[model samples]
Target chain A: MTIRKTASDYSRSHEPIVWGLFSAGGVIVAFFIPALILLTSLLVQVGIADEAVLSFDRVQSFAQAWWGKLFILAVIALSLYHTVHRIHHGLHDVHIHIPDSLAIIIFYGGATVLSCLVFVWLLAIGW
Target chain B: MSTSEKTIYRKPYVQNQSASWWLKNKFYIWYMVREGTAIFVFLYALILMLGLLRLAQGEAAWNAWVASLSNPAYIVFHGIALIAAMYHVHTFFKMFPKVIVIRFGNWKMPESYLIAGQWVGFVVCTAVILGIGLFVGV
Candidate 1:
């Protein structure tokens, strides 16, 4: 067996994994558009756009009936992961050598924190 | 040369097939497009949050926010965001069939069919939203 000696070989081997990340990211993002539109329409209807109502009371009522919040969460979380993965590879192309484990930790860690913050904020506001 | 005396030919050089730009750089391009969309989405979320905050404040605040959005700079930023969003949507729908697998007993659906269904769903939803917005003035 001949050992592969080039970047092309490395990429060819890893193409499927890269494509999987991209495709999954895409589907998640696609679903988000309609979900977002629905959420916006709800906000408009509830006088959230016309009145001073930041209390959790308003959001809980909204989310109770609208299942779009879950989709929003998924979109944000998946897109965050997708962002980090793509950026990591881009940095690699520029000869940056971040250890794989450290990179994954940082990326996913950031995503988790951000997602948690979103949930907490929404819940705190009663959504 | 006589058939028996013929020398076997061996090519002295093999052309390098790996240096072409697309072959060497397509991955990078894909990375850029994907990451760029992510960043755009992040920015879009921020804008959306701002709008939500303003809405939560009051109608005056919401109107002010909409008015601000009418500024040239905001329009440009929103335009860029819209373009980035469309790119993300188009690319994502193209890949939808592969990521999620739905099996119906003995029948399996193809990816293209799934993507087409998604687009149809999107168009229908958009139409409904637009109809509601126009009819209700919301």
Candidate 2:
């Protein structure tokens, strides 16, 4: 079933909030992801970083730090929502149209669920 | 024939783009790649989230998780993810200028300038983050 939209309702769509999250997530991906890749993957393999860099002691310390927790929270939650928003539009652009309500619920719901989990886990880290 | 007397009936070519249009050309393929990178990025975020969860569980679990990172398969996965992330960064910067409008005195900022500004901001932000992390003993 289609809910009719007046001009104002159409104009005041909640999409911008998703778009804002998407854009913020894009910034996190751009600025931080390479460093993450280096730290977690390439550096240790290539021997530029010590194996201890990712050792539980150091990483846990980092995660327990206030800034680390905040940063990780932002990166995880924002990227999830960003990717979901992209997936939502990309699916539409590629002509995989389900009902709008269903599409929104699935895409946004998945992000929201995982984001809440991320927050809970971040806090559970005992900072 | 006077111009007003001519009645031309032209057939309208009503062609809707196919869903697989991105597969047809390099341009579309690249656009798809740019869009597709988001999933890999989301995966990376999930990986980090898992790491956080493991950290919360205590050293044994966290260390085991860390140890798994050295696996050849995990390494290769991360490498692909790294490429996807770089593509995301490049494309995100390219899109920045389109969304942002800036003026310098009477002149509008060029797209190149806008792109460069994003890079500069990223660099500065990274430095600040690293500096804080180090100084704060993290």
Candidate 3:
């Protein structure tokens, strides 16, 4: 849509790194988020998991398991990355332009910090 | 004849743009809702992360966390978040095919195949997780 294409006018963006994370996170959420909300909320609210499932003892042991830790890490980190990326671009599409440096530091930077915290918390309780 | 020349420019009309510009169009509104789903999804994730953190801290912490979730307000919030997450998943599946086009030697693989395959994979994975927990006594 420009009068002429110029070499200096176009450049590849480094978006794919975050886009990949966003896409993976979306896939993960698509696969599980609704079910997660359902199982954790509705089922627990009902008779299911009242005494046994998700009980303190059960949940603690589940978290202590390696597979449980991996699942938690993947879900939390990816979902945060996905959500922040969406919010960042969502602002742009709405014509709310924040400075790029600040947006990056806040959104992606926050994700990095939280993801690290998840890893640490997972480790703190020991195997 | 030497004359003073005046430059005259016509002012162009500009469309009204506002922070709520998306409200002007149905499609834009829908798109905004899709993007906004992430907020609810993030809220759900944050609560879950807190639950995980408390679970890691030990039985006392996990019990307190579970007790907190029983609040009426938390239940209401989770209800809204659940609905939003469902919409997010629906939009995610629809848009996923555009992200990666599957191609065969000459003809392209149909988008339907990819979408269906994703659902199948989702089912299999979910089954594996649940089955192990049940069978292994975890």
User: Each candidate's lDDT (Cα)?
Assistant: 0.58, 0.80, 0.81
User: Candidate 2: DockQ?
Assistant: 0.51
Error of 2 at B71 (Å): 1.5
C-alpha lDDT of residue A55 in model 3: 78
Give the candidate order by descending TM-score.
3, 2, 1
| Residue B41, candidate 1: alpha-carbon lDDT | 63
Q: Which of 2 and 3 is ahead in TM-score?
A: 3
Angstrom error of the Cα, residue A105, model 2: value is: 2.4
As a TM-score, model 3 comes out at 0.87
Model 2 interface CAPRI class: medium
Winning model by lDDT: 3
List the candidate 1 regions with Cα displacement exceeding 4 Å: A1-25, A34-72, A93-96, B1-31, B49-68, B97-112, B128-137
Residues B72-108, model 2: lDDT tens digits: 9888888999899888888889988988888878999
Among incorrect, acceptable, medium and high, the docking class of model 1 is: incorrect
How do the residues A73-113 of candidate 3 rate in per-residue lDDT, one tens digit apiece? 89889999999999899988889889999998999999999
- What is the Cα-based TM-score of model 1? 0.57
Candidate 3 residues lying further than 4 Å off, grouped into runs, are A1-5, B1-10, B126-138
Model 2 chain B: which ten-residue window has the lowest total lDDT?
Answer: B129-138
Assess each model's interface with DockQ, reporting 2 decimals per model.
Answer: 0.21, 0.51, 0.57
